[model samples]
Target: MNGGTDLLGVVSSLLGPGGGSAVDPVEAAARVAWSALVEPGDAVGGLLVQGLGAERSFALVRAAVDDGPELLVESCRDAGLPGAESPSVLTGAVAEALARWGPRLGRVDVLAALDAARAVGARLLVPGAAGWPRAVDDLGPHAPIVLWTRTGRRADGPAVAVVGSRANTVAGAEATAEITSVAADRGCTVVSGGAYGIDATAHRVAVAAGTPTLAVLAGGIDQLYPAGNFELLRNVARQGALLAESPPGTRPTRWRFLARNRLIAALGAATVVVEAGARSGALNTAHHAAQLGRSVFAVPGAFSSSASVGCHRLVAEGRAQIVVHPEDPVDTVLGRSRHATPGRGRSSSSGTPVLAGREDPEVLRVLDALGRRALGEQELAARSGMSFAEVADALALAELQGLVVHGVGGWTRA
Candidate 1:
């Protein structure tokens, strides 16, 4: 093993100066190592990083590999790993994680990965870095240790993930464009996987609209996957960013794509499916979003269209809210604003920007009217004894408060 590798020196030379980087050099190097050492979204690995920090965890892995996991239990405790409640459970989990990680310790060269990354002008980002987006932290123990990105330190705004099948129809493409256009129009960063159909459409629209976008790759940012989107990925990197969890020289595998879904889901406030077949991989992203408690929406197509089968399944199973209105995705991303552009508040002294969801009478009234089902403004106004404009504004305000969610058909309690 290259345990003697001068991590600080290697990273300092390879990454150079990053304009007062908040990340520790050794921590950065260790993250680059972990990105290759473990598979994507490894909860045990995430926990190790969370508890021991990247640099220390990397050392722990190296030690366990050379020796055995038996001696590392005390080290884990000394390192302050927030293991399971029971001591035996903690010991068992550490043993299992070490067993899985032991094989890769000697194979991956952290310094080489960093050198290759810098060779391609890719920037390395570790947790707590200035440009790092905290949203992915929502995944908790499943979060990534490092992100290799080309531009934009963090997404840092409203983002909605638009994804669907590679074999998309013209209609599906059109719908995807509309969603992306409206989202970008409202100043939301459209996040996607940079795949062929719907993902490409979303990126193209975001780029064309001159809005920030993020394309999260399953492989490496050094080589854009799907050879066709090379230029498009470049445009995305230029306007916003091209990011990946896998290190340089890594290929996209089926399991990696599945792991990538959780990242796409975590990066956005919502996930939108334009079109998909019964087994479309986009469904995987949607399911991940649902698990993370992020809103999910699916655009309905013709009942007879096979491409829409998975979308229909989402609606039928009550997993996703239907995108009945064109503004739904925009609302999902930018929080249902009717007049204001996404940035800054038009608030006076008493604007009620952040409701606690129950105290405000207007919010409570809207929630009571919403009850169990989604309703349009007119129906809510009539039911809640409020005027149409009042209901509209209240719903808009409540959407931001997370007290209610507008699913296009109407509004419902969150």
Candidate 2:
């Protein structure tokens, strides 16, 4: 047999009975050598044995048995070793595989790792792909190896991540919805971790607004962690996508949750912390965003509310922008007005210079009635008591005159 095939057989043998501590060192070395040959699509039986050595590797394999073969291979590959191709490998095979491959494992760089992952049915997403989130690339090296996604449509728009504490207040939930609604209406996707509280509210509102939203999960894409969010996650998958770095069937763990925060931050143009305690996990997302150079905004709550403490600290430390409302976030991202001078109203008479100045009372009233929410032409006519033709003329003039802004569904005050 070739080195690779021979190593595979030896690993299988070491995994069998009597291959425990009684196994010969040379046989054990061969078993370890076999593990180094693991590539994507290899069987898991031998790999499992190689991973669970006579002692340490054994327990590790047993503990991870439920994680599935893909995850096992990933773990092995990450450890710079090969995984067994079958279950019958001796317990000592893992050490042997490691020893054999240890010297030449330098070839298994990140690119090779990605190739291996793809060979095993997992898709590798890099920055600049149609579905590649700009937010994630901002994470630098801390970013995930690859995002394993299983959705029909990949998200392809600017996304605002809404994160907060699980035990959020009623006001926090309301704010999350309102902010998410604003984002959706403005053509921004919403990204969250599919957790309870603010994350769930953001996704719900974004969906209601007919906007795409993405959910990053700490567990496998196929496995929903918080069982409570299974249905919600399904809806997100239909409307947007559910992304995970781990292969399917991997369970969520505490470390995974922490690492997942960086993904959330990197996937968004900006992150808004609606509510979080002093030490809430949401803060981790904010930190990741700041580190990635993405905008981090925080909604301030009452001084007495524990949930708002983290946000307050973030803003005070200059790590985040203080967003009193959703518009503040939008404006921050779009940038401040270049002209310092105030805008002027258009003259009713012909031959007037268009300059930055205050608007007339009539125009102000019309805009005030329109509010921040978009109003259709007919709605604006009815609200402003202007004739249909006059409203159309006014709206057209307002847009050209820079008194108001036009958007997809309707018009909103500039």
Candidate 3:
């Protein structure tokens, strides 16, 4: 038998034991076969064909074959070249499994796939890659095994995760936009799952601001989860990166959504829950951020609104900092203000001044309103009277300035 098939058989045998502790040998073999068969910078199609199962393998092979033998021929051409073939096969195998199972597999399967993928890639970044974010890993082991990425021409930078409910209030949408703009001005990349409400707002604002933003897909990178966000996803990929743990052609699943949250948390220096109910998925993301040791922030809402409950609870439990304004630049809330501080008169080319002991005036106003008590935006606005737009603009400025901090419920002085 060809070494590829032999490897698959081996991994299959290991997996056949069907016990909690048993490692699937077939999977291990698949990992080996994948590493042998594919190369870095090679077309993804050829890799899929060489590593996938019988039924799926042939289909993918056919697609690549039909596209003309360029990719397949290249794979064979580069097979023995140095740096072309990776030392570990585990990553390819795990990535294949993630693609195959889609969202059906349990936490064990996901972890195994991630482990294998990282082993093979030799760049196993979890929530702690130098850029490993504590926010996403807080999801615990349910976190993604690897973040398959291909950076762009621009420098890789910090990102903020903006997430909220699908059926969100107008206020929520506005908040997302304001917060995203602030992040962009601070030279931070905005990360989101590309969902509705807050996620959409965050992306749109980032794009409009001419800043880089990334979208973490719960499904395949080839397909956008929400059909409506297809254009937005494309824009993000062009400006920044679109990431996925699973290979192409996978569909979104409930468990994947929960798992996907970790990516947003992990990628972002800090996580902001824009608007979520007690049971909202955004709250789940906040929990993961806490677990990962990332700073958590929240935007407070109306006391009577169900959407505000999650943020309120997070603040009460000390799980999140309350953000009253988007511009408050304290690291305690967004976890990024520390990096934004000026270093000996050096200013980032972006023109946004680094924090240097000075504070944003808008953040000061919001803090004065919070005064050791969590206050919703409406109350803060009523007390400050600065129009909603003015308040939002100030908050966004303050957040970037590191003068104030935001959390689950509202904003406070740092």
- Scored by CA lDDT, what does every candidate get? 0.75, 0.59, 0.55
Tell me the tens digit of each residue's lDDT in model 2 across 306-361. Answer: 88887777776566777766776655444422332221211212222122213554
What stretches of model 1 exceed 4 Å from their correct place? 1-20, 77-83, 152-155, 336-414
The prediction achieving the highest TM-score against the true structure is: 1
Return the top candidate by lDDT.
Answer: 1
For candidate 1, list the clashing residue pairs, or say none: 375-410, 375-411
lDDT of 1 by residue, 86-159 (tens): 56756766665676677887787887887788888887777766567688998887788888889843456778
lDDT of 3 at 246: 59
Give the runs in model 2 whose Cα sits over 4 Å from its true position. Answer: 1-130, 334-414
Candidate closer to the true structure by TM-score (higher is better), 1 or 2: 1
Query: What value does the lDDT take at residue 26 in candidate 1?
Result: 66
Off by over 4 Å in 3: 1-143, 150-155, 329-414
